[model samples]
Target: MDMEKEMFDIIHTSEFSIFSLSQLPHDDNSLLLGYEGKVKSFDGRTGKIIDLWEMHEQRVNTIDVHPGNSNLVATCSADGFVRIWDLRCLGKEQPKSIKEVAHNRAVQSAYFSPTGNGLVSTSTEDTIRIWGGPHFENLSIVKHNNKAAGRLSSFSAIWGWNDSYIFIGNIQRAIDVISTENNITTPLKSEYMTNVPCRFATHPYKEGLLACAGGGKLFLWTKM
Candidate 1:
């Protein structure tokens, strides 16, 4: 189907394309959105754009509010940097801290780990880089593939389970569960999905309930 048809399908299914989305800490009623380089906070149910900020030099690739700190927001961009911003501050204020080389290449995705201790990011460089905190500093970069060419296309997506294990998805239509318990490299089980996921989100209050946007359909996975 084409774009119009897709829109119709989404409307019928009670969903829409999200350019970039983040849930406010402790307040599900508010959402932070990044669309076309503009950031806005809105009432989730009413669709009201409560606050707006436009400071990114390029299109925003990701937007995440600090899990325990509602005042802070983190964003990554095509410009090759990750930034921590204090949303409580006013307009025209730049990010509190900007990591100029947060990623070697365009950051494809970024997210705060569920436990609120740090951030997990992925880039087109085909590597997953973990930052110790929202500052995007004190980082450790994990190369997903040992081979050079393989690493180039070996992109990744990440989600956390109690900060103990992070579920990573990739273009290969496979998921890798990484354990943060020992900071060791061990490959766990992989789930073969029907298609590369277009979007993914974990349930805030449920165990093993994964909301996956893939294969032109939505899936809810439950743990056995």
Candidate 2:
């Protein structure tokens, strides 16, 4: 019998600290990293930077790659804006589109829809916004009161497999299943958990299977 071996690999080092990171959806060897008011793409295998830019005026909070188009990246920052970047552009260029004041307070997270035609952003102001197009037209807004700040401010949200719905965590220790078409929120039952669920991820290959975590515990839920 052979045993599995573990190895540690350092991809890149820099003077600045990294706050957020996301890999290109189609490329495992590439990554998008967020640091103090800046974002960059690095080749993980070679430890060489592919592109770099000062993206925001404050520390970037989150980065998400477009599911259908890896070249499109979405980033939110403490400056309260959500900017979409085209990775094909040169390092010195500006974002392809910027959602100015996407949230009234510091933006916590921003993600591209699975279809890559829309974007979703959450903020410390207890609001989640949906946007469409490169110009970032406001499509919808869902409000909830989960006001933790700083490192704890960020709550997870992701589109459903078919893009018909979104799953968001709330302060009340449950997940909110929101309908994209009607903007209705239904709380998922979580009576067994003692703490608020701060993050959620749907099963990649199985429908109705979800994994959520917070307060040092993980919970798995499936459709009944």
Candidate 3:
């Protein structure tokens, strides 16, 4: 409750209103923020903005830094573009996009696989696209029911431990898993899951556990 209230206040503050945030890998003191159409890096301890990069025509919905390469970061936005940025190249007024794909519609989430060789993105409608290969081309399009969730932090497809399994919530009160290698869809249902999960987080050490949040509650799932 306290954290939610704090976030509510922060979102109302124009100077601190953030659409998305990301933590830079291997750098403990730096943090990344997607404010409006710009990306900024700040000193986490001092609340000082160090650098900024212009990004996205619309608000960035999600930002995911490549797990293997910290220099490679990805973002999806309402502007219908999913992009990868090389953080080594920065310009607040003219940020360079290393690579991008035109979704042609608002994208909700773009996440890199744990191996960082693959990427998975969720759209506002019916498609979940997976990108891979040397250039991260559009590899496959999987059908999914993602039209339900509406808020800023809504149904997002996420990766499990390795690069094989992807997790996303459905309206049926179950978690859906999409296999990247075999291209199979599976549903994970539990009687304890009463509400549809909208957001997910993973722990660094506990690779076997995943947590999901919705309805002001959190559910932790373990692989056993």
Worst 10-residue lDDT window, candidate 2: 1-10
Which is better, 1 or 2, measured by lDDT? Answer: 2
lDDT of 3 by residue, 42-77 (tens): 785676787877788888888999988898899999
Instruction: Report RMSD (Å) for each prediction in the order shown.
Output: 6.4, 3.0, 3.8
- Where does candidate 3 clash, by residue pair? none
Runs off by more than 4 Å, candidate 2: 1-4, 91-101, 133-138, 149-153
lDDT for position 71 in model 1: 81
Error of 1 at 55 (Å): 3.3
Q: How far is candidate 3 from the true structure (C-alpha RMSD, Å)?
A: 3.8
Instruction: Give TM-scores for every candidate, taking all chains together and pairing residue i with residue i.
Output: 0.71, 0.88, 0.88
- How many clashing pairs in candidate 1? 0
Candidate lDDT (C-alpha), each? 0.63, 0.79, 0.82
lDDT (tens digit, per residue) of candidate 2 on 10-85: 6688888888999876678888889989888899788898778888989998999878777777888989888876
Judged by lDDT relative to the true structure, which candidate is superior, 1 or 3?
Answer: 3
Which of 1 and 2 is the better model by TM-score? 2
How much is 21 displaced in model 2, in angstroms?
Answer: 0.8
Best-fitting candidate, scored by lDDT: 3
Global fold similarity of model 2 (TM-score): 0.88
